[model samples]
Target chain A: MTDKKMDIIRALKRAGNNPISGEELGGILGISRTMVWKYMKALGEEGYVIRSSPGSGHVLVSAPDKLYPSEIMDGLDTSIIGGDIRYFDEVDSTNDVAKKMGSSSDEGTVVIAEMQDSGRGRKGGHWMSPRGGVWMSVILKPNVVPAYAPRFTLMAGVAVAKAIRGLGVEASLKWPNDVLIGDKKVCGILTEMDAECDQINFVIIGIGINVNVLIEELSEDLRSSSTSLSEIKGEELDRIAFVQALLRALEDEYIRSKTSGFDSILEEWRSLSSTIGRDVDVVTPQRIIRGKAVGITENGTLLVETAEGLEEIVAGSCIHG
Target chain B: MTDKKMDIIRALKRAGNNPISGEELGGILGISRTMVWKYMKALGEEGYVIRSSPGSGHVLVSAPDKLYPSEIMDGLDTSIIGGDIRYFDEVDSTNDVAKKMGSSSDEGTVVIAEMQDSGRGRKGGHWMSPRGGVWMSVILKPNVVPAYAPRFTLMAGVAVAKAIRGLGVEASLKWPNDVLIGDKKVCGILTEMDAECDQINFVIIGIGINVNVLIEELSEDLRSSSTSLSEIKGEELDRIAFVQALLRALEDEYIRSKTSGFDSILEEWRSLSSTIGRDVDVVTPQRIIRGKAVGITENGTLLVETAEGLEEIVAGSCIHG
Candidate 1:
C-alpha cells in the first residue's frame, strides 16, 4: 500500500464518531495543513463527505463518495470483496488493470475507474463508457477449472439484478448474459478468464452500468437500447451509495455461489430473467436454434426446447420477443 | 504502399532475369545511389539475399526475416489474409496491439514481433520468447458468433502443426489447443474475438512458437521437456522463409476450416497426433477421466475411452504415457 492510501485510512479512523482536526491530521500524515486540506478536497471530489469546521476539525458525517476507498473502508462489512480497492482516474480498461493485478493481488480485490479509454465488452467489443458510469472490474481466484468458470457470469448476473432491485428499480436478466429494464439494457457484464486445461489462473468480471449518464449522450445504437438510473428515475441517484450496495450484494452472492453451489443463484436469476418462457432466436456458426426459453443449468447454459428437442447454449446473442 | 516497398517491388520487376543498374534504381525511388546502398544493406540485414555489383543495382535472390510482410504477401494468393503487416520491435502483448488495430485495420492484416515485454499464453501464463522465436498476432475480421470463435484456436493449432511438418519437423497437436513436439509443447495459440450476441466484429490470433529457441537457456522444467528447431537441427534456419511457409499454410488451413468444415482438418490432425491410441489422463473441472486417447472429434475435442465409458473432453491438460 502507498502512503496516500494509508493517510486516507488514518483520516477515516480518526473521524470515528467525531471530526478530526485538519491541521493535526496533516501533521500525522507528515504534510502541511494546506496539503491536508487539498487531500480532503481530493477525497471529497472522489465522493468522500468530510464536514468542515472553522477551528475544530473535519467530520465524516456521511459517505458522499461511497465507492471511494476511504468511504468504503470502515463502512464496507464484507469479508473479501472490495477489501482492497485500486481507483484510477482513467485507465485502458478496469479489466486490464485487474488482470495485471491478479497474480499479485488477493482474490476479491476490485479495480474501479471514473472512465475507460479502452473499455471492453464480451468477445472484445468496445464498451462505450464516457463518464458518470459504474465501471468496475473484480479479480477472483476461484479454485475451479476453466469450463466451470462460466458459472461465475451467471452468479454475477444474479448479484447485479438483486443490487438493482434493492434500489427499487425493476431490472431483469436475459439468458446467457444481460441485465435489462423493461425491453432495454441497463447493464452488461463481461467475464474474462485465464486458464490452462484444468486450472484457472484468475477471472476478471467487468461490469458496466448506466448510472447517471444522459440518454442523449449515448451512441446512436446504444441510445435506443440502453437506460440509465438517472434517466429511469428522472433524477441523479447517489453513485457512491449504489456501488456500496452493489459490492455488498456481490460479496454475499459470490460467497454463497462458491460454497453452496449455483442452485439458489440460478433460482434468483430465473426470477429476474425476462428471457425465460419467451420466444427467442439464437445463432451459432454451426446452426441457428429458435425455441422457447426453458431454463438455465448450473453450468450457466441456457436450455432451449428447440425442434430437435432440448438443447443447451453455452453462449449466443439472445433476442427476446 | 510506401515508396520503399514500392521501389523494392519495381526493382524486383525490373530485374527481369538480369540485375538492374544501381543508378537507375536510385532514380526510380527518388533517392541517392548512396541511400540505395544503405537500403540494400538494411534489406540484407532483414535476410534478403540481393546480388549487387559496383554499377549493377540488385537482384532479389532470397528473403531473410521470416515474419516480413513481403514474404507473407508473396506466399498468400488471396485477396485478404496478408494484405498489411505491422512489425514491432517490442510490445506489451501482440493481442493488445491487434485488438487496438482490430477496429480500424483491414480484416487480414498481421502484426509480428521478435519479442514482447508482456507476451501472454492461455490462462495468463508467460509465453517466454527470449529471442529466436516466432511471436505474431494476426488481425482477422471473421463474421461469426462469439461461441464459435473458439474454433479459431483449433484452426490455428492445425495451421501451426501443418506449417511445421511442411518443414519436416515432427510436430503434433494436443487436445483443444496446443502444438506439441514429441511430448513437449512447441507452440501455443490464443484466439480473442469481439462480437455481439450473433455477429463477430473481429478476431485476433496471437501465435507463439519455440522456433530456434535455445532449450538449454530455458527454465528447468521447460529445458527438460521443450525442444526447438535450431536445437534439433544443430544450425540456424532462415526465419523469413519459415514465416512465409507458416503464413501460407495458415491461410490455406484457415480457409479450409472456415469454408469447407473441420472434417478434413481433423483427419490431418489425427494423422499428426501422437496422443491417440495411447494411455492418457484427461483432467476437466467437473471430473477426471483416465483412459485410452481413442480419437479427436471435428470440434477439436478429445475422445477418451475410459473403463466407465467413452467421454468427450472439450478443454483439459492431457498427460500421456
Candidate 2:
C-alpha cells in the first residue's frame, strides 16, 4: 500500500507540467487503472490535489491545505525533522517503524501516522490514542551514549510542553516525559535509542498528543487523567502548525545537545518540570524507594532523598504525590 | 519456519509409539509430502535421528546430537535461557529479533541464530560472527529499572568469561562488557533494555562469541584486536556445552542478583576484571577522561581516578592501557 502511494507521488512529480494518464500510472504501478484511480483518490484525500480529467490525464495541481510531504519538503526550517517524512495511514506503532529505520535511514527522518493501532505508554501500558490525535516518531542520530538517552526524553518533554503552551493552553512537563495540563496528561513522549558501548546510533522520539480529541472521546478510566488541547482551549488546533512548532523546538534542543552542552537544556527542564520537589515513590526492580524528589543530575539521573540518604535513580517508574 | 518446526516436533512426540507415514505427516503439516520429507531431513541434520523404513514410514529413533529445540526442551536448567528459543538459519541479528520480541514475549525467552547477516558490536560497530559462533540474545524480565541494565551487561561479561574459563581458556573481563583473551576481545555483550519513568519491561542480552571463528577469518583490521577460542586453543570447541555453561553461569548470577545483594557478583567482577588498576581512556559523548581504572560500583559504573581526582564513568567506550 505504501509502495503504491510512493509510486503515485513519484509519478505526479515526474509529470510536472504535463499530465499523466491513468493508463501510464497503472503500467508504472503494475496495477489496474481502477486501482490507480483508487490510489489517486487516497492521495487526494491525504491533501495531494492532483487534478484528474477523464481520458485526458491527471496533473499535479496542488497539495491539500496540510503539511503534506510536498509542503514539508518545500520549505522546512530545520535540516532534519520533516526533511524525510514517512506518512502512514495506520501503523502498529511509529516507534516500531522508526526503530526499524534507525539502522539504514539518515538521522532526523520522521514517521507520522494518523492513528497508532498499538500506541504504547511507559511501562508497557497502552497509550489511549484516538483518531485526530497527533501520533508521530522522529529518528535522531546522536553521538551521545545510551546512558544520556534519558535527557532526550526530558528534552522532548520540554519541547512538547512548550509547543502546547504555544497553543495558548497552560502546559507543564511531568518528570521524565509527559506534557500535562494542571494534573492531567496532555501529551506523552517515548524515547527509544540504540547505542554501542560509547556512542549512540539513533534515537526515536515517539510523541502522542491529544490534539483535537475530546474528553468524551477518551476512555472513562483515562478521562479524568487525560485532557486534549481542544478541550482546554475550546477550539481545534492546526495540527500541521503544531507539528512544525514541535519539530522546530525539538531541533533547537537536539542542536544544543550535539553542539553546545546540556547545561542550559537541563536548566530549562528543571524550570518546566513538576516532578521535582514532589513526594514520589520510585519503584525499581530492586526495591521501592519513597522519597522527596530532590533534583535531576547532569547525567540525567533523578536524585531522591530518603530516610537513609540521597540516592540517584537511573531507571524506574514514579508515582507522584 | 520456527512455528512449523515446533508443530512437527509436537506431532512426533504425540505419536510416540507409532511410525508416522509421509502421507500422514503431509496431511498433518498441510504441506506437500516432499516438504514433509525436507523438514524431516532438516530436523535430522540438526540432530534428530529418524528411523525410516520404506514401507513402514518414518519413526523417531533417537534425539540428534545438537542443542536444537527438542534437546533444549529436555530438562534445560535455566528458567529463562531455553524457555522460548527462536532459532534462525540466518538473520540480520538476534538482538534485532529479541528487540522485536522484547515488547511482548515473556522474560527468559532466548533468540539464537545459526548465522547473523548483520551482527553488531557495542557502539554501532560490526561484530564478526560466522556460522560457528554462538550469536544469541537472551530476554530478561528483571524488575530493575533501565539504569541497572548496564549491570546485566556486566553480568553477561562475567558469565561469558566464567564459561570460557570453564573450557580451560584463559579469560579476562574488560570493564563494561567484553570478555577478552590476553587483551584481545573474544566475546562482546550488548544489553538493551526498555523502561518507563520508574519501571522496566525487559532487558535483551545480545552476546556474540567467536567460539569457532578462526582469527584468519576475521576482518583484516580486526585481526589484531579480536581473538577466537578456536584460534587461542588451536582447535574447535563444543558450542552446545559452552552455551549451556554460559546459561548456567548467567542463571546463577541472575538468581544471586534477585536473592542476595550485588556484593558477591561485584566481587567476582572485580577479580575477573583486567581493566582494574590499569590506566585507560574513557571516552564519553561530552568529554574524555584519562585515569586509572579503579573499581566498578554496584550500579556497574566504572570508577576511575584521574589526575584531578576520582570520577564515576557510567556509559562510555574504554581504551585500555
Q: lDDT scores for all predictions?
A: 0.77, 0.81
For model 1 chain A, where is the 10-residue window of minimal lDDT?
A: A63-72
DockQ of 1: 0.15
Return the interface RMSD of the candidates, in order shown, one decimal each: 6.0, 3.7
lDDT of 2 at A123: 62
| Candidate 1: tens digits of C-alpha lDDT, residues B35-90 | 87777777777667788766655678765545556554554565667788887767
lDDT of 2 by residue, B36-111 (tens): 8889888887777777888777777766434465545544578756777777778999998887778789777888
Clashing pairs in 1: A47-A65, A123-B193, A123-B194, A194-B123, A195-B123, A317-B197, B47-B64, B65-B240, B66-B239, B66-B240
For each candidate, what is chain B's TM-score?
0.85, 0.82
- Model 2 CA deviation exceeding 4 Å by range: A1-74, A182-184, A196-199, A270-321, B1-67, B182-184, B197-199, B223-227, B231-234, B277-293, B303-321
What range of 10 consecutive residues in model 2 chain B has the weakest lDDT sum? B64-73
User: Can you give the lDDT of residue B77 in candidate 2?
Assistant: 79
Docking outcome class, model 2: acceptable
